[model samples]
Target: MKQVFKRPESLIDVPAHFCPGCHHGIIHRLVAEQIDQFGLRDKTIGVASVGCSVFMYDYFDVDVLESPHGRAAAVATGVKRSRPDNFVFTYQGDGDLAAIGTAEIIHCANRGENVTVIFVNNTVFGMTGGQMAPTTMPGQVTTTTPFGREVATAGYPIKMTEILVHPTIS
Candidate 1:
């Protein structure tokens, strides 16, 4: 049988801590592959937000900056602005981006910050024991919402893409 080997320059090693059926691993691989394909390993600067992905810095071989909860965008803004020649991106989960960092994201997108944001909307806060996130479904039950989320009180899930695509904003 022909043996398949890992990409020679890929940064990720085996043994990830993500849960079964979680998409984080796939996303991480995709990002790493893109970095390799574009020869961006040296020019890319990743900003990792709090939550499950807080340890992303350990996985990626490139330079990374750890940002406080809900503050990845702010940090990325500074990095990109300071080093405009480098590629900058943020990896953020729903709880970090849609919930705690809503204002920062809005302003960043509105201002057209020259950075990319990878927003993972898993519907629940994964790290904090699966609590209801701002993107959780209306009827989904979470640790914090044992009886299912009520739209009347909690309001609708914020569609971040929609918010970012608004004509005035984008």
Candidate 2:
């Protein structure tokens, strides 16, 4: 029998826990596919952040570490520094990365850490009752912002990649 579909070796066989309409599973598959393509399954170490994808350790076949809420970048930094030969990455959502772990992520990028960050910007805090996250678009509504987000008061959504690449950061 010819198998047309097979799960990436870097991903586990267990069912995912991500909710419907959520992109966590798709993002996870992409990450796993990259790891498989690079033949990094054995040498890759993943840092699982808080929020919806906290159970990432159960999905990825590689070694996975759990970081404190919003501390995945810091934890991945230490892991990469301790074992420079390994490929380290962090799986973080908008709520965890853009809101709680902003400082940690900025510092990690500024220092040019040898790590990859798989940031999933779903706009809302999916794990925490769909609250308004830092990545929530302007005029978008969430549980916390019942009347839609007010940029005058809430400020614009943060563009993390731009902040990371800003010249002022270096």
* TM-score of each candidate structure, all chains considered together: 0.92, 0.96
lDDT of 1 by residue, 1-170 (tens): 88685752657565787889888877888888888988989899999998887767878888999996899999999999999999999999999999899988988988889999989899999988999999999989999989999999998998998988772622
Q: Model 2 compared with the native: what TM-score?
A: 0.96
Q: State the lDDT of candidate 2 residue by residue for 10-71, as single tens digits.
A: 99999877777778788888999999999999999999998887878888999999995799
- List CA RMSD, all candidates: 1.9, 1.2
Off by over 4 Å in 2: 167-170
Residue 11, model 1: Cα distance from true site in angstroms: 2.1
Q: Candidate 2 clashing pairs?
A: none
Q: What ranges in model 1 sit over 4 Å off?
A: 1-8, 167-170
lDDT of each: 0.88, 0.90
